[model samples]
Target: MLSKIRKNLRAFSFPLWIVAASFIGTIFLVWGKGSVSGPSGNEVATVNGEGITLTEFNREYQNTVTSLKKKLGDNFRKFVKEDDIKKITLNRLITRKLLLQLAEEEGLKVSDWAVAKYIEEIPAFQENGKFSLELYKKFLESRRMTPQTFEDMVREDLLIQKVLTAVNRAPSVSQFEIKELYRKVFGKRNFKYKLFLSKDFKPQVSQKEIEEFYKNNREIFKKGERESYYVLKFPKTKEGEERARKAYKLAKEGKFKELMEMKPQPLKDKELIEKVKEKGFSFRSQENGLELAFKLKEEQYKSLNEVRGEIERALREQKALEMAKKEAETFKGELNEETGKVDVSELVKKLKLLPTTNPEELLNAKVGKKLILPVEGGFAVLVPTTEPEVNEFEEDKLKRLKEFVLNVKRDSDYQNLLNLLRQKATIKVNQSLFRSVQ
Candidate 1:
């Protein structure tokens, strides 16, 4: 009977499903106060008396904040409101706590060496394919993370994850489920489009809406958010020579470094050297010796104003992302926020991304020149240029837009599902650990 019970439990375990969702749903949290007094001495939250530590929570919290900011940047606070961050953090921590508790109930386990080995392989802390002590120290200093703290966090994370894997074994998903999952996950149609340009859509816009849109976003469409005039080479714009001369003079004078310091760097990034270098490495004008010079963090661009186009472009790209999201909503054929369900095949058919070919090109498909893609909450178009546009954002933008909108609805849906399941769960939490959180 014991063997039968174990076998039956195995039947219910769906390791693939759990593992797929495990890291995909990476933790997002805020710093929790206190530390683990000893290895697993106290629990932050528990399910059936299991311990989740403050240290683990803090580590994940920092990562969550870092990951979110990387993704949303200036807008992270806007989308992930303070209350939402805390709520998500608490919920994430609690869920992990419960999962670990379940793992313990089943006696799932991992070795310290497994975690140690994994740590050694992390590229961020590595130098030339090996862990570098210097890189490790610099990283911790930059994030205010310490070695002991980082190790405990990684260990707990690995142990919990390993335990979850043990509890949820393979072959539990079953062939029937896999077949169904296959369609749900991969059922998509490709779109082929003959772009209806802005002009085409322009006439359809109501006078009132157009005027209203213009009024609210007049600033958005303003030419040259950067006040600098373009240098129209061959017959450049007025002041074009002056602008070029100014940049050339700055480079010649070797004052590029001083000039760089005078410009505004984002307040949040001032303390972050690597991140600042990342932002400033790319320049506006064509590459020359100046590009090589700026490669040294101590070296700067020709002049701040000379690279005003870069600044303006960066800022414009930021605004465009938000605008793209807003426009995706209400786009026809979209998985609207309301329904949250899309017959993706239908979309593929509509978008003409289906496998069917256009015979006119004779064994070659006539790739649409310009096509506006409507996402769950944004609209985007790909316009082919003579040259590849800087930061094509071709793949990343579409993926992000989908994650932004589809996930909005998907998140709520999943949470509601969890709520229903939680009612049936026998779980407990360490209230003292979280009650004082800001």
Candidate 2:
């Protein structure tokens, strides 16, 4: 759980001290029993000679999965993969180890009194706005943790927090930078634009053009070899293997009804196309499970006649885009500079001309200047109708902008520090053991 919270703590936008204050109670639960250990063959990785055990990795990984499930709910699987979570968990562990090592080298120390004071401030261990020993003990007992163990984790977190604070001290912004940032944030400019879209300039495409395009870009029409298969995927364990063998026997005996009753998934495994011949089955081992694949469909590509309409439509769009660009270029050359306006009322009646604001370009463009810019799906001719101006001075707004600039600088510094540490450190990972971890 501390690993998960530390992941959030890395965001320098939020003050590290504030995060530590709020999450002090939950941080101790990260390594309940496996907080301390010696070197072992079960190590997943080592950072600067310090080994990260498998027990620590599994605990952190489970915590991350549980946290994400709660936050994302049913959409969890769509956004995150198990393998990615594992990799992230491992990286967090490595980074945490590095930060702690750096803290030690810098002579950072969290006294017992400091830990006690920090614990007293946590709301979870307080009753009626005061520290309660009874509540603290009860909290630890409920989680099956000793006071010493919890205090140790709190101290480590404090040390890391100190290192982060020292590295991310607020940077000083110059007066010129402040004025420039204020202008960029509050400045606005008025402009008039006329857009030319391919759909509006419909061009006729001949049959010969379609055939010629298809001939030149045959690979674009080529499709990947697809296969339909019935997969019986099970855990890579003894019992799972036994069930797979029985299912394979039923499949060979043509008892598809029984196989279907066993809940074999009717899926497509494109990667197994060449390995599994038609009307034959193959046993394959995956990272998380073993599968029996029964091939169903053969590989084939679509004929030219089947894609003729698609090719024709593509050619028409291409010709239309070319004509639209040509027309826009002509209008750009013949535009009236003094008036700096084009009648787009008729085009607006036909299609939406969404306004796009680019602050940098708007600030740079002089009054009455004309610019031909490329927009989504077309080109646009723009004329600056008004000059850019900054907002009126406000003390509160200026303070907030200064804080924002400092936060950005701190975030950059933190990342650079981590990158430098990684380059100078010797890190080794046990790939085979890591992959074999369930």
Winning model by TM-score: 2
Cα lDDT tens digits for candidate 1, 294-341? 222332224443434544444445455555544443344422122112
Candidate lDDT scores, in order, read 0.45, 0.67
RMSD of each: 19.3, 12.8
State the displacement of the C-alpha of residue 156, model 2, in Å, after optimal TM-score superposition: 1.3
Task: Report residue 187 deviation for candidate 2 (angstroms).
Answer: 1.8
Question: Which structure among the candidates has the greatest lDDT?
Answer: 2
Model 2 clash pairs are none
Error of 2 at 74 (Å): 4.3
lDDT of 2 by residue, 380-419 (tens): 6767676545657577878899888898877667666666
Models 1 onward score TM values of: 0.37, 0.60
